[model samples]
Target: MEEVIENPDRIEIEVTDVTNVIKPFKFTKDTSKSSLTILNQSIENIDIHEIWNNTTLHICADGGANRLYEYGGDKRSEFIPDFIVGDLDSITDEVKDYYKKQGTKIIPQLSQYASDFMKSMSLILLYFNGVEIVDVDEYDGLSKLMNQLNDKHLVNINSYILNGLGGRFDQSIHSINQIHILNQQYPTLKNVFINEQDIVFMIPKGRNLIGYNSISDFYKGNKFPVIGLLPFSPCIISSWGLKWDVRNWKSSMNGKVSSSNGIVSTNGVIIECDEDLVVNIER
Candidate 1:
């Protein structure tokens, strides 16, 4: 992960087109629920309040509900989650009741096979796909619920998951693993993990435009937003709009993995790859 190649040729990718499509949703300060955001239990003093306000459907994963309740404090009433999901083990009775009274749908999935994070993901797919479970209280409702989504039409939604990283090391790895698996199961859904310091997402195979309208639009004051092009599996990658640009760069877990790279593009960054790659940018 530490080796570096100097003066590699930049690959040609359409960054401007990709930026045009995702710019409004990613950069806008407008207060409208245009996407989905999930909160995990490791919530801290995150400054991305605008993301919370702009998310239409917010779901908390069990103890994630607890963290959100505690973080909101005086403004607790203002940040009620749309759905509080997972096994009822981590959520406190008081916090549960508070959100329940506020009309939040509390879903309890008792299956130990999948983690609370995965359970919440299933709930998101079910809700977005318009598949309502009549036996919503079933211990493993999400298990069967996901099956029903096969016949239903699902709209592609961008998911911003918070507190998924910066926890236990194994959990962070698992979260990244789930990101890859989820993309395979549900190809349309784009999942992004948001930690306190970085924003991470999977770059799909072929060309991907990591676009932005302006530098300030994504990172207000940072002249060079630090980034990394990580390879969980073997892949051939090439890039543009970066300080250390690479062409046909072979990357893998045991080989050269691009880390501590910086974005140099005024507008956006473009990456072309033969397989899916994980990308992280400092926020």
Candidate 2:
């Protein structure tokens, strides 16, 4: 599989709306902000406070609550999570009591089948389906509510997850696996992993017009943000507005993996692909 540099003859296509997926990066206030989830990892160099202020819903995956508590320090009271969920493994009693007093819903998900991250996502899914967050007493309730709805499409709520990446190799791979599985099962549930240097998410299979609020600012600062169109499997792709744009290029893990690609357009980049791609926008 080789890159097709020449695409003088190509038909125009419709652009998918992915602006909402990248709204968190814009630093603009919105009536409907994305939800935030904290994982069990050190949030070094990440501004957790700014993200907390922008999110509508918040969840801490077990020990993640402890991380949040320690990170908040004296201002811990101001940074309460909406929900703390897990098998009661890592979350300390004092930390739990603190949040419990602040009216944080403590959910005990016992089944080890899904990780705390997945369980947290289950809560998000339940909430998006119009199910009251309080009614979900435990992990089983999550499945019960899910069965009641039996709907493929849940509310399209954008989610920003912190500390999900750059951890243990297996765990990081698990997080990425969850993102792929979540997108396949619930296409509307847009989950983005926000790390120190990148925002990772799945770009759907179709023509997509990817953009940022202040792309020209990056250019002005002489920092054209790097990007990638990583394929989970073999697929054909074409792109515009990138420094190394490709046309009808065949892509896959075995060959033609696109990475370290730069964004050159001041407006946005239009990527057309036959399969869903895992894209990482370098900060």
lDDT of each: 0.75, 0.77
- Estimate TM-scores for all models: 0.89, 0.88
- Top candidate (TM-score): 1
> Which digits, one per residue and each the tens of the lDDT, describe model 2 over residues 1-283?
4454422222233346543233435433434636889999988578777678877899999999998998888988899898898887999999999999999989988778889999888888877678765556464666566665575556677788996988789998899889999888887778888888888888878877775555653234465778888898899998877777788899999997889877766656788888888888877
Q: Over the full model, what C-alpha lDDT does candidate 1 score relative to the true structure?
A: 0.75
Residue 107 of model 2: what lDDT?
Answer: 90
Weakest lDDT window of 10 consecutive positions for candidate 1 = 16-25
Model 2 scores a C-alpha lDDT of 0.77
Ten contiguous residues with the weakest lDDT in model 2: 6-15
Clashing pairs in 2: none
Instruction: Please report how far candidate 1 places residue 254 from its true position, in Å.
Output: 0.4
Q: What is the RMSD of candidate 2?
A: 4.0
